[model samples]
Target: MEDLILKHVSLEHPANQQSHETEGLSSKHLVVRRGEPFRVTLFFQGRLFNPDRDSLVFRAQLGGLLVKFPATFSKPQSYSQWNAEIEPGKSVRSQSVTVTILAPAFSPIGLYELCLHILTQPRQYSYRIGEFVLLYNPWCPADSVYLQTEDLREEYVKSDVGFLYMGTSKNVIPRPWEFGQYEEGILEICLDLLKISPQHRRNWQKDYLCRSDPVYLSRVVCAMINCEDDRGILKGNWSGVFKNGVSPSEWSGSADILKLWAESKFSPVHYGQCWVFAAVMCTVMRVLGIPCRVVTNFNSAHDTNANLVIEEYYDGMGKKLHMSKDSIWNFHVWVECWMARRDLGSGFDGWQVLDPTPQERSGGIFCCGPSPVKGIRDRHLNLIYDVPFVYAEVNADVHTVIVQNGQVLSRSVDKERVGSVICTKSVGSALPQNVTSAYKNTKAVMPSNRSTDGSPRSRRSYANREEKHTLALSMSLDKTPIAGETISFTVTVTNKENSPKILKEHINAQAKEYNSSPLETFWEVHNLLRLAPYEVKTTVHHITHSEYDEMLLGDGLMNLAVVMQDTGSYERVLVTEEFNITNPLISISMTGNDYVVKNEKREARFLFRNPFHIPMSGVLTVMGAGLLHKKVHSNVSLQPGEIMEEKISFTPKAAGTKMLHANLVFKNRPMVIRGFTTVLVRAT
Candidate 1:
């Protein structure tokens, strides 16, 4: 009895003889883009085999079916040919034999397995050599949809870093997170994602990439990441009502979420918010060779009724009334994918919005746009997909009405607040790029053909008329406030009349749900003030975290408004401000080690203090892209004035600058304290 073994294998270009070896084949996955030419060389040896009398057959299988190759077995080149060793008594022996595999340009994108069968006498021996993955070529003429600018290529196509901008427009802050799409585990998850089709099987056509379009593929991704129909991938719970007690923002990367989803086939991934959904979708898109960038819209409007207006009503006592179906989120995150809209034709090819947040439905499914950005800017609401819905997200008028006993007391309109800065991560950097102008009109320009009237004044004229008749009311708040702290703001009212006047002042603050209506009222204050002619009065109000927690709605984002009315003239004015009550920034120190080598395990200790007076209990999650896999310690309780310490053991799998994130969420409280540190991982 003798054994047959594969010595080595290599892929080479026939003309240039440029080769890639398959020595540690399983460890290294071969990659090639569509329309590329390459030849595979297989070297094998057998103990009792005669090369002159035995024949070998090579076969390539894709999606469990044999794929046809154009050519195989070129004339043996000197460097790869088999040399026979003439033995004294051994029957004609060959040390090694080489075979060449020629793949055509039309070979589709997929994992192709190569197998070799040796035939001698009545027995045939078979072995699986290796597998190669074919990807879509962005540089190819037929794949021009993936072609992007250098900046876009760096930010969306190549880089796995993402930025989530929270807070208002005046104080926009960026939170950096990593996506591990290039990781082997994440790549496997993405490949599996393509196969789990709930409603449709359009992700891969005939198990071939060339047969499908990018537009449809992107839509499928948006639907899959949300786990809308199928078990899906990410479970979304914006209300923080998760069975695991961990908020969506606690998770660090898409890889961990996908890994959890893969491990627990019965249970979907724990949690994901808008940014998480968008970030994970970016990973999936980029892994599939589609250019994608996560976008954050400040003061994003969610018009549930398809109307280009977000309306809010209030009572005379300054209590916010939930009368309208529309609402505005302090910030919302979505992804913009670059692709050619062959389905929609010319003038619509570019970055298309694809939101996987699962807020509303589009075309009966939970997937959102392929809606063209140009159409949104030009007010082409008649276009396909959810153009009207997205148009209002970036350019919508906010109208606030004060009513008492079903009578409209006063109404004011704000045209500049609904959607503020539309931002994305800058190319090759972590900074934000203001792409507001790309989504809507930045300069003073004529209204699009879809406008109610041809003139821009129609939008601003109503607001100006209300301002002239009502007293000047302005509301200002301290720069971004943190939870577990007192937030103070002043409301100033000016009486411009010549005669003395009596005014009624109403101040209201209420918690609001993301993309939904306002929730329970947190705090409210009503007062009567008398002002002399041309007199200005300023009143300050303070709110504590305990008071905010009492009426905390979804995520602790609040809508504060001040309504003032002139009792003498019966004129009214309203001023509103939107702010996010973020968790107090606790000091987090990472010690024990500053760096680690790739594939080496290291332990790091982290100390984070609880700034709140009351004891807190929640989950502490530590995660990183290539540095540390997700390690979470649940039911971590911290006493007042106590510093909680956690030790994390992680193995660095990839080299370069890696980020380690620690998120602490207090159960039943709308506070989520987060801290991160960058570590250098050298290649092993």
Candidate 2:
């Protein structure tokens, strides 16, 4: 044994990485997928190796955890444990030796140090061979994170560009997002997220050990995404004021946010909302080799109590009141990770919910899930990790109460309002794929016999229920309203009975937050509406910019309601419409080149028009990954009906699909306009 001389060691990083499909994870280390075998070779000037006389032990370490396993002399067969084997004939060779090492499917996914021990002649010798990274394998059948098809894995794990569904369910809008998992500095920061979490700070070895399970990893990532409990990634901001940090709307991709967090030494990135949090989490998951997708729930319920009931308060004139802590957001975004839930019994394996929004606490932490979607859909309250909470988020009943002072005037229970639509980006496309049926049964078969269809006829039918009163009332927006312009809407009243009826119409308007209740009323009008026998009448009213500009200044949410009371019968009917005044759009166009080339300068022009009766001034910020190195900003002023065009020049950094995002934030007013264009950069 003393005569044996060691010369060189080989980790076979390229072939191992290619076999593990980890060529994109990193370039500095040997990256391999867990549950697969990677070869390590030894080249030395030594006597013929003897397995019986010389004992070998291999140690793989993560943080403070060091696992030692004995090496066998034959080819490996079973993969039940962490084991290594020398090639069948290489163990008896004279010069070079090859050994295959297999990390179990459930091995923790992260960087690991490999060491070899040779025991002989009453002494043990050790050598530090190399380090490697292990990641979840969607292609491996034995892995819990495995997906069956290549198309889904491509869509969920490989696609760097995605669209987040927003706006009302009736009019779903797709917002482009750059996952940028493969971009420079993104994968490094993503791995750093795990190391920076509170669990890692407390006991890194324990944290790393649990990373073997996608369930545990998802839970940790969920908590780390919000900075509430731990000094994690994004600091959430739902309030309209963004004075000290960047607005959530200003962010178009995860690379910028993750890069900022890493560059700032893991300080929480300034601002993030639900969609931002979800999008950033998607990027991190994809970078770590997990299949994940962003999902949106329209009319999503936020039930403070676990009673499955969301109580909403409104005034007689139909202005919503902030009396209850529970809320119904127009839309709430979260992520669904694909994995097999072995902890839960059968039927729980599949897409599991993992929301990063700091909405509620689970087991005394701000993390919301790894909640089994199957458990939520099946009403399995006994399941762990806040199943009941997510169940209520999509299955709660809306209890609408109209109160006057301290008295309740009108009360109705709407079961179909919450979770009316659940959707995600379609595979290989920008269109939305409805997933409402996956969470719960279609409501058309429920007692309400209502459909989740966002068609105008269905909405009208849902809005106007035949009442016993004499007058039938309905309300609608005149056109898609925008801020900095007049707001106009129409209210119709029809006589249902044979006799003529005179009615008093009370029209009111109030501003509100996205999920919270409305604040004080900004405007109201009263009119005497008279209808002849079988006559229908429509009236239009306008509220100039000055009338509700203050309300639009924050969240751009407003509610219009009309209460009609018959003069003879004293019967009353109320109809209301909630709307959002969208900010003006900044149209972005490319120039100078027919196609974007890597390492070449390109220009993008931003065009914005002033549609108000007053002058406007704002700051424009533009950013792109693999397109621009950093954010670019400029200032502009525009008169009424004036169009402003600004050009920004930047050189492409890497070749791939990229997105150019432009945002115009009004300096003197509360408005943000957003636009994005996709660029396919050709490699030079």
Candidate 3:
């Protein structure tokens, strides 16, 4: 038995196909899901090995903790403990051995080193095979992050492409986002995110040990997604100017951002908004084996202090005042991860909110949740995590206050404006599945669950319009406004009384941002009109393209209002409507009904039409994972009503569902148009 030496080891053989490591299956590292067995074969040299007398021990090490188990030549029935064993008959006087290593469902996740010890007569030997990575397995029933629903696991864990619902609730825009968890180098970056955390820096061993718990792992991921602490991944930027880095709107996927973060030595990426941050968090959570989905709350309120109210102060001329501390966004995005809450007892084990946006600090850190959705719905404000903050975002009351010269003129409270629509992308589809009912009861019952008296607040309204009128006043757009075209809207007024009346119509338009208050008035019209007794009249107003285009910056948006004052009675009515110019679309079509296979070339054509009479010029960038290794840029110019066509060629790198995205950034204007085509890559 002097020549009983191990010759070769096999990990990439066909035996590993059942590991369910789609992304990492083709990776160089030994990638696998927890609670499942992965096989590694060993070949011996010279003479047949005698397993009856010789002994072998397999050990796996993470940080400072080491686990060792002797080879039993039999499979362990329970996945509660890590075990390694050789096949019984293969070890019987044979020169080859097949070993199975089963990691428990509760093992700490990260990179681990595996070693083997061979004990024989008069000598002992040890071999360092290689390193492997362990990720969460939703398919594993014994795992803490298990999801029995196959569709949910497919949508959350396996699906690499998804959408983030943006725009207002009335006109929700489904923005495509590439989660890219299975993309090359992305899983490693997600793993490195945990390694660079403050918890890991303080005590590496304790951090690794706690990773066995999904709750702890998710909280760390939330805090690490924002740069407010730990110099994390994204530095959020809400302001329109993104001179130093890429604007949050320009990022179509997370892999590019993750790669940039890693290539920059783990420094914070230049900028990220709510959706961008949430998308990155989803990628990390899903790649780590936690089921997650991106959610959008239209008319989402931001209560500065725990008060359940968002106040809106408007001046006498219908100008929104910036006096209040609280503000409401047109929409707010966050991620909901599915995990069992063993800490919160039973009944609270469904979807939990985990916001990575740097809005407020929780536990002196910039992370939000693992706050159970049921807790928010049932008004369980006393639970762990930041439930009060999330509850206020969706359920806060809007108190519209007309403040002029430090005096209150008129006040109205709107209960349905905040969180009128809350939803996420549906499973296996691009349509939105409304989850608002899951968050709040449809009865419109107001809960006084939040504490009061912290500070004065404010809220903005866009979804529903409230009207209180002496002589009825209403304003609405003729159609959805588009860039480089005349915007037309009609104002309707009626003398409700039985007598004739004289009125003054004050039509004002001010530039506004999506998140903050409106700026100075860009356009206004004052007209005196006479109405017959109990008569209804409608007037159409138009803002020329050049007139509104001069004030357009960052985003093509404006808050328009018409204040009607009765010259006879001194009573006034205000009607306001906020609208944005929709960007043109870049339409893409493939060559034919052909299958996109990995490592094969495909051709696509992108077409764009310039609706504006004026000439348009911009740079078109085309990119996709598994298709294009890097972004391809081409300068494009189009005349008025010109339809331009461009062709692109790409070769996929791996087999999976992928998307090819094209973005056209207009020169000297803050306008952009996007288009994408889905590619189902088959194995070549």
lDDT for residue 504 in candidate 3, whole number 0-100: 80
Sequence-dependent TM-score of model 2: 0.88
- Residue 447 in model 1: shift from native, Å? 25
lDDT of 3 by residue, 568-597 (tens): 876666656666677777898878557887
Using TM-score as the measure, the top candidate is 3
Candidate with top lDDT is 3
* Model 1, TM vs. native: 0.80
What's each prediction's clash count?
Answer: 1, 0, 1
Q: What lDDT, from 0 to 1, does candidate 2 have?
A: 0.81
What tens-digit string does per-residue lDDT give for candidate 1 at 185-276? 66656767767655335434454544246776777778888876666788888664677734675656677677788888625687888988
Worst 10 residues of 2 by lDDT: 454-463
State in Å the error of residue 557, model 3: 3.5
Q: In model 2, how many backbone clashes occur?
A: 0
